[model samples]
Every structure is written in structure tokens, then in C-alpha cells.
Target chain A: MAEKKRELVSGSRLVDENSLKERLIVIFTKWEVILAVLIVFEFILFSNLSPYFLDYFNLMNSTFTFMEKAIMALPMIFIIMSGDIDISIASIIALCSFSMGFASSHEIGAAGIVIIGLLAGLSAGMVNGFLVTSFKMPAIAVTLATQSIFRGISQAILEDQAYTKYPEKFAYFGQGYLGETLIPFELVLFLVLAAIMGFVLHKTQYGRKLYAIGNSKEAARFSGVKVDRARFINFTLMGLFCGISAVLLTSRIGSTRPNIALGWDMEVITLVVLGGVSITGGKGNLFGVLMAIFLLGYLKFGMGLINLSAKVMIITTGLLLIIAVLLPGFLDTVKARRKLRRQQKESGMVEV
Target chain B: MSIPTSIKTITQRRETSLILLIGVLLFGVTMRAPNFVSVTNIERIVNDTSILIMVSIGQFFVILTGGIDLSVASMIGLSGMSAAMINQYNPGMPAGFVLIIGMLIGMVLGMINGAAVAYGKVPPIITTLGTMSIYRGMTFVISRGQWVTAHEMTESYMNLPHGNFLGISNLIWWGIVVSVIMFYFSKYTKRGREIYAIGGNKVAAKFVGVEEKKIHMTIFTLSGILSGIAGVMWTSRFAAAVNETAAGFELQTVAACVIGGVSIAGGSGAVVGVVLGALFLGIINNALPVINLSPFYQMFIQGAIVLVAMLINTLSEKRREQELLKGRQQ
Candidate 1:
């Protein structure tokens, strides 16, 4: 009778173990679920706190506040995922915008000005890529130097002058709304771009290579991954995106200055990291990043409605960044402790 | 053979190239502006760079441990603002006392960062980056977006930087004293050697019984204390304190360390190299205005110099490795 009781208990424990595995898998696979819940929570909290938060027009207009930054964050995801960073993105925007402004001042056509802006950004990225790949320079140091150089050039050229001569139609990219809809054109662009980026990062073989390289560069190289090429392309893509962001930002502001988008690199990086991308690399998804952008965008919007100072908003963002980084590790530790306790209990029961 | 050996030595030691570059720059500036080399002008340059030297010394320690403190500039601003506010409120508070208070505040701030990085397992860059904004925001909150003007500052506070100590300015004397103390500490102390070892190979160092967490906290705290001291000196020298004061100086400090041949990768740097780095930047800054160059050129020149210095360092390091490989083959 005792032997029979032991067999029954052991069988029940097996069932319990299977159920636990399923629960763990669900939790692990649904990382985006947490982010989605947080977004809803934030939406509810903000709308209840401020009267103006629920207005469609106010919400649409608010997207412009961070649309440029969101656009850049798309490419930043890939860069960070590949175990590299491009802090020079903001500076690239400054340089590209300044170039566009210069071209506009010289009576260049709108199309020509746009082309010049894109070319300038591409060239800047190429320089960063070349130095990093050829010389084996640390990406952070290389970009940091280029950031200074690019911004310096803009400062030298502009010298406190604001350029406002862009053609009227150019404003459509930044300020226009979808016809009869409350959606912003820039938001539409962001969504389309995010889809493309998501497909590329999640569905493509190149993306897998990026993860491999990020996890272990030498191992990835030995496995025949073209690490250098991928890194170079990612950086170039970063510059290209920066060019687009510059156009959008300049259009929205209706002017360009050397210091435009100054210190924005930090904000963009915060968004990317908050989106679940690891700073040390090799893990993250675009879905989390999209949710993060909206989370922060609305957070700022809600705060703005309540008349919080910019300094306070910045502090909140910083605190949010720290929390976002710390929370995952905290959760993992908690989960691990629980599992350990469960194992101890199971073993004790088995012995009994 | 002798000439080649001397040349090799000059190139092998990074500081020698920096010193030679400084000499070349001075000669060029003196040629362009005859008064550039005057004792008064030289003294002025030293005075201007005193705060820079102090901050760089702190940054060097953090970087030597393969970590960075991006919040140093913000710490400077906060400490300076705190010092100014204390002076404003008390009016009778001694300058020395206020300085100590400022440093204590900085230490508390640094401890927060150290705890986050060491105990919380956050990367140093991310931790410092987050704190940078938080501290800067705190500065605004403390000052209520107000500036402390020269009129509100005590006479002694203003005199701290300008006051003569022996034959040199008080600021230079402070730099000299700090550098000497740091030099001795880094060279003679077991903790200092452990910092370098940890930077060189973290896992190996840990296996050898180095308490990395404690050392990380200590270095960051040290950096904060030094930044606080620099803050006090900055406010004294300028006789004004504002939330934006010392903005972007963190990058400048890092640049100074890099230019002085302090590897950003860490494990190798010296107090002497860092001081020379500050002096090099100071001379360039002083010479630019005197040479009648556009103020705009200064930013470009500074960026170019940093980039070139890094490139040179990389090339030299590569060559050194190649030589080592060749020696092994033989």
C-alpha cells in the first residue's frame, strides 16, 4: 500500500512538472504581452490624469514630438543588436539638416536639397563604417569622434544662423495629416518603415547572423558570417535613416540650426533600450520598441499637458531608463528563486 | 644605432609624442602671436585648465578601471550650484566649509551611481548616462532655475582661484597637489594596482581575489569627490554658478585623457599624462583666440585633434603588436 501511494504521488508530480513547463514557455514567449499591458496601463493612467489626453487631435499632434526620434530608433535597434552603437546619429541629423539648409539658401531645388542631405548622411556613415571596420576601432569611440566632427562642421557653417527657406511642399513630410483622418503622415511613414525593419530583422537570415555575431564575434566569423559587411551596412542604414529624420525634423520646425537635435542621441538610445533591446547586444524585438516609443511619447504628452517642466520630464525619462534596464534582471532573479524553491519542495516530497 | 634607439623610445612612450606635439603647437602659436609665451599668458592658461585637470584626474581613475562616469559634468554643475547656494544663504560660511559641503553632495551622488553599477549590475555607461540627466535636473530643481551672480558670492570664494600660493596661482597649486597625491596613490597603493588589473582582465582579476564590486564603487566615488572639488574651483574661478555651468566638460575631460595617451580601453594611464593632456588642450584653447581664428574653428580643430590622436594611437598599437609577433617568430 505504501509503494502504491508513492507511485501515485510521483505520477501527479510529473503532471505538475509538465504544467509548469507550459506556464514557463508562455511567460517566456510572451515578452511583448507585458509591454502591451504596460501600454494600456499608461494610456488609462494618462487619460484619467489629464483632460486633454483623450483628444484625437491632441494625440495626433503629439506624435510629431517624437516621430523623428522613433524613425531613428528603428535603425538603432539593428545597430545595438549587432553589438555596436551609433551615437553619431543625432550629429548626422544636424549635419544633414545643415546641408539641406545650405542648399536651400543657395537656391537649390527642393529635390536637389533632399538629395544633398541624403548624400551627406550616407558619406558620414561610410566614414564611421570605414574606420570601425578597417582599423578595428571601437564603434563607440569612432562614433563619438565623428559626432563631434559632424556637429563641428555644422556649427562652423551656420554660426547661429537659422535656415528657413525650404519649399512649401517639403513641409508635408513633417506636418501633413492623412486626408480626413486623425493620423499623421509622419506616423504613417514610421509604421511602414517599422514594418520593413521588422520583416528584415525578424524574418531574414541576415538578422540571425547579427544575433550570432553579437553573441560571439569570433564564433560567428568562424561560422562564415560576414560580420564586417553586416556592421558596415547597418551603420550605413543608420545614416540613411538619420537623413530621413533630419528632413522630417527640419520640416516640422520649419527651420534648421546647427544645434537642432542636439543631445537627441541619448533620447533615442533610451527608447531603443527601453524597448527591450540589450545594450550588451544579441537580444530584442521590434514589437517591444514600437510599444516603448508610444509609451514614452504619450508619457511626454501627458506630462506636457499637465505643465511639467522639461527638466522634470528629462529626469523622468532617465529614471524610466534605469527601471527598464533593471526590471528584466529583477524579474529573472525572482523567477529563478521561485524555481529553486519549487525544486527543493519537489525533491523533499520525492524523498518522503 | 643610438639615434634609432632614442627615436624608438620617443615613439614607444605615448606621452613623448604628446609632449612633442605640445612643443610644436606652442612654437607655432608663439610665431603667430608673439605674446603667447609670456609668463602672464602662461599663468592664465594654467588657471583656465585647473578645473579641467582636477576632473580629468578623477575620470582617469574610472577609465583605468574600464568604466566611465558620464555624469561628471553634471556632478560639477550640481556641486557648483550647491556651493553657490550655500554661500548665498549663509553669507558668513567659510569658503573651505562650503567646498567640503559641495564635495559631500558629490560623494552621495557618486555612491548612488556606484551602487547601481556594482550591486544592481547595470552597465557603467548606461548608469552614468541616466544619472547625468537626473543630476542635471536636480541642479535646476535646487537652484529653481536661478543663476548665482558674482555680486552674491563672497570675496574669499572669488579669491580661491586667483589667490597666489608661493609663486604660482592657487588654482595651479591645487592641481599640482591633487596630481601629486593621485600619482602616489595610483603607483603605491594595492587598490590602485587592482584597478588596473581588473581593467586588464576582469575574470582573471576576480579569480586572483580582487573584489571588483568594491573597487568599482571606490573608483566611482573617488571620481565624484574630485568632480566636486573641481566644481568648487569652477565656481570660484568664474564667480558665478548656474545649472548649465560646466556643460559638456565631461567630453572634454575624456578627450583630455585620450589625448594624454590614456587608453579608453583602460588598464594604462598616468597622472602625469593626464595633466599634460589638460595642458595641451588648454594651450590650444588659449592660442586659438590669440591667433585671430574664427571661434567656430575651435570646435572643428578640437574634434580633428581628438580623432587624429586616436588614429595615431591605434596605428602605434598595431605596430607594437606586429613587432611582438615578429620577435616571437625569430
Candidate 2:
């Protein structure tokens, strides 16, 4: 009779474990689910707290505030996913902006000015890529040096002066709305870029190589992956995007200074990491990053609506970055412990 | 050993090379501005770099363990502000006591970073980056956008760093004392050897029964303590504590480490080298004005020096590997 009782219990345990596994799989597999739920929670909390937060017009217009960072975050996703980093992006922006300002000073048309900005960005990024790849220097160190070099050039040139004279058409990239809609040109550009990044990250051979490199560079190299070349490309891509961001930012602000986009490097990195891209590399997805960008964008908007200081936003973003990293490890531990406990109990019961 | 071998040994030490560089810098500047080499100007350059030397030594401990404290600048701001506030509210508080309190505050902050990086499994860069902002924000929150200006501080408090002792400024004395202690600590102590072991090879260190977690926490805590002292020195010297105190100072400290030949890959560095590196940077800063170079050129020159220094270091390291390979083949 005891043996029969044990068998019956074990049989029920098997069924219970299957259902538990199914639930766990869904919850953990879809990182986006967690982000989506958090977005909903934030929306509910903010709308109730601030009367102005729910307006569609305000919401659509607020994208301008973070569009530059959002666009920067896309390439940043690629950099982090490939297990390297480029902290020099903000400085690259300052460089690009300075170049465009120079071009404008020479009466270059808007189209020519944009080209100058992009080319400056591309060359600056190439400098970083070349140093990192050819010399075999670490990305962080190379970028740290370049961060100074790029910004130093701008500071030396600008020297407490502002460049405010841009052709009228140049502002449209940063401030214009879509045809017959409330959507901003900057926001539209960001969304289109995001789509391209997401596709390239998820669909292309290059994307697969990034993952393989992130996991283990030596192993990937042994498998014929051109790790340095890939990293160099990511950095160059970073520079190009920085140029894009600089143009947008310069347009939106209508001026360029030595300190333009100061500290955006940290903010953009925070966005990428919070989006589920791991700093240690090899783990994370693009959708998770997109979800994170919006989650944070709206959070900032809501915070602004409630009349909180930007300092508070800084603290909030920092905390969110830390929690984003900590939560996954914490959840995995809990799951593992529970599973171990259940197994031990079942084994102990059978023995009895 | 032969004379040639002895000279080679002396030149091979990174500190020797840095000293040569500093000598070259001094010669170059003296050529431009004869006043730059005078006793008073020499003292001025060292005095200006005293805070940098302290923080660089602290950063050496963290980087020695293959971790970095990006939050050092922010740590300085917060602790300095806290110390200034304490001095403001209670004028009679001894400078030593205030320093202890400041260090304790920094220690706590460092422990948070250490805990996150060591036990929590967060990468050191990410951990420090997050704390960098958090601490800076907390500075604003605490001070509420207020500045503790010169007149607000007590005379005794201000004298802690700037006050001269026996014909030398206390600032230079503090820099010397900290450098000596760290030099001994890194060279003589068992804990120090353990740090080197772990950084050199973590798997091997673990196999040999070294406690990685304990060392990681201790490294950052030491960094915090030193940063705290530097904070006190900074605000005391400047006679003000504001939210932006020591802003962007982390870069200078790391540049010092790099210029000193502290391997960014970890497990090798010397206190003397770091001191000279800081001095190298210090000389450039002081000489820039003396040479009639616009201050605008300062940032560009520093960045260029770092890049050149880094390239030299890497190329030399690659050469060393080739020589080792050649020996193996033979």
C-alpha cells in the first residue's frame, strides 16, 4: 500500500513539473513581456500622477527630447552585442557638429553641410577603428583617448563661442513634422533606423558573427570569424551614427558648443544595457533594446510632466540600469533553488 | 653586471623612462620660460598635482585587480561636499575628524561598488558607471544646488591641505606619505601579492585558494578611502565644495596610470611610475600657460600625449612577446 501511494505521488509530481516548466519557459523566454508589463505599469502610474502625461500630442512631441539618443542607441546595441564598446560617440558628435558648423561658416548649402558632418564622423570613427584593430589596443582605452582627442579639437576650435547660423532647411531633420501628421522627422528617422538595425541584427550573417564573437573571441576566430574587422566595422558604424545624431542635435538646438551632447555616452550605454544587452557580451536581443528605449523615454517624459528635476531622472536611470543587470541573475537563482528543493523533496519521499 | 647591462636595466624600468620624460619636459619648458624651473614654480607644479597623485595611487589599487572605479570623480564630489557641509555646520570640528568621516562615507560607497562587482557578478565598468551617476545625483540631492564657498569654510579647515609644514606645503607631504604607504603595501604585503595573483590569472588564483571576493571588495574600499582623502584635500585647497568639484577628474587619474605603464590588462604597475606620470601631466598643465600656449590647447595636448604613450606601450609589449618567442624557439 505504501509503494502504491509513492507511485501515485510521483506520477502527480511529473504532471505538476511539466506545467511548471511551461510557465517558467514563457516567463523567462520573453524578456519583452517583462518590459511591456513595466511599460504598462509606468503608464498607469504616471498618467494618474500627472494630468498632462496622457495627452497624445504631448506624447508624440516628447520624442524630440530623446530622438538623438535613441538613434545613437541603435548602433550602440550592435557595439555591445559584439562585446566591445565605444564611449567616444558623444565626442564624435561634437567633432561632427564642429565640422558642419565650419562648413556652414563657409556658406556651404544644407546638403553639403550634412555630408561634411557625416564624413567627419566617418573619419573620426575610422581613427578609433584603426587604433583599436591595427594596434590591438582594447576598445575602452582607445575610445577613452579618442574621446579626449575629438572633444579637444572641438573645444580648441569653438572656445566658448557658439555656432548658430545654419541654413533654414537644415532644421527640418531635427524639428519638422511628417506630412499631415504629428510625428516628428527625427522620430520617423529613429524608427526607420531602428527597423534597419533590428533587421540587420536578427537577419544577417554579420549579426550571427557578432553573437559568436561576443561569446568568445578566440573561439570565434578559430572558427574563421574576422573578429577585429567586425569590431572595426561596428566602431565605424558608431561614428556614422554619431554624425547623424550630431546633425539632428545641432539642428534642434540651433547652436553648437564645445560641450554639446556632454555625458550622452553614459545615457546611451544605459539604454542599451537596460534593453537586455549584456555588457559582458553574448546575451541579449534587439527587440529587448527597443523596448528599453521606449520604456525609458516615456519614463523621462512622465518624470518631466510631474515637475521632477533632471537630477532625479539621472538617479532613476542609474538605478534602472543596475536593477536590469541584477534581476536576471536573481531570478535564475530563485528558479534553480526551487527546482533543487522540489527534486530533493521528491527523492526523500520516494525513499520513505 | 657589466656597465652596459646595468644601464640597460636602469633604462628598462618604466619609472626611469618616465623620469627621463619629465626631465625632457622640464628642459623644454625651461628653454621657453626660464622662470619655469625656479624653486617657487617647481613647488607650484608639485602642489597642483598633489591631489592627482593621491587619486592615481588609489586608482592603481583597483586597476591592479583588473577593475576600474569610474565613480572616483563622483566619489570625490560627494565626499568633499559632505565634509564641507560638516565643517559649515560645526565650525570647530577637527580636520582629522572630518577627514575620517569623509573617508567612512567614501568607504561605504566603495563597498557598494565592490559588492555589486564581486558578489553580484556585475562587470566593474558597468558597476562603476552606474554608481558614477547615482553618486553625482545624490550630491545634487544633498546639497540642493547649494555651494559651500570660501567664506563659508573655517580657516583651520582650509589650512588642512594648503598649510605649509617645515618649508613644504602639507599637500605635497600628503602626496608623498600616501605614495610611500601604497608602494610598501603593493610590494610587501601578502594581500598585495594575492591581488597580483588574482589579476594575473583568476583561475590559477582560485585553484590556489585565494579569496577573490574579499580582495575585490577590499580593492575598491581602498580606492574609496584614498578618493575620500583627496576629496577633503580638493575642497580644502579650493576652499569650496560644490556639486561640480573634481568633475571629469577620473580621466586624469586613469591617464596617470596609463602613462605610468600600469598595464590596462592588469597585474603590473609601480607607485613610482604613477607618481612620475602624474607629474608629467602636472608639468604640461603648468608649462602650457608659461609657454604662452592658450589654455585651449591643454585638452588637445593631453589627449595626444596619452595616445602616443599608449601606442608606445603597446608596441613595446608586442616586441617583448616576440623576443620571448625567439628565446623559446632557440
Q: Against the true structure, whose DockQ is highest?
A: 2
- Residue range A1-352, candidate 1, lDDT tens digits: 2544774575476567678774654455344677788788988988888989999889888999999999999989999999898888889999999999988989887788878888988888888888889888778778878888999899987887889889987888889989988899999999999999999999999888888878878989999999999999989988989998998888888899888898899899999998989888888889999999998998888888888898998898888888788878887687667658878997999999
Candidate 2: pairs in clash: none
Model 1's chain B yields a TM-score of 0.96
Q: For each candidate in the order shown, give its overall lDDT on alpha carbons.
A: 0.87, 0.89
On lDDT, the candidate that comes out on top is: 2
Candidate 2 vs. true structure, TM-score: 0.96
Share of native C-alpha contacts between chains A and B (below 8 angstroms) recovered by candidate 2: 0.57
Q: After superposition, how far is residue A305 of candidate 2 from its true place, in Å?
A: 1.1
Off by over 4 Å in 2: A1-17, A20-30, A345-352, B1-6
Q: Predict model 1's lDDT versus the native.
A: 0.87
Q: Name model 1 segments beyond 4 Å from true.
A: A1-31, B1-11
Instruction: State which docking tier applies to candidate 1.
Output: medium
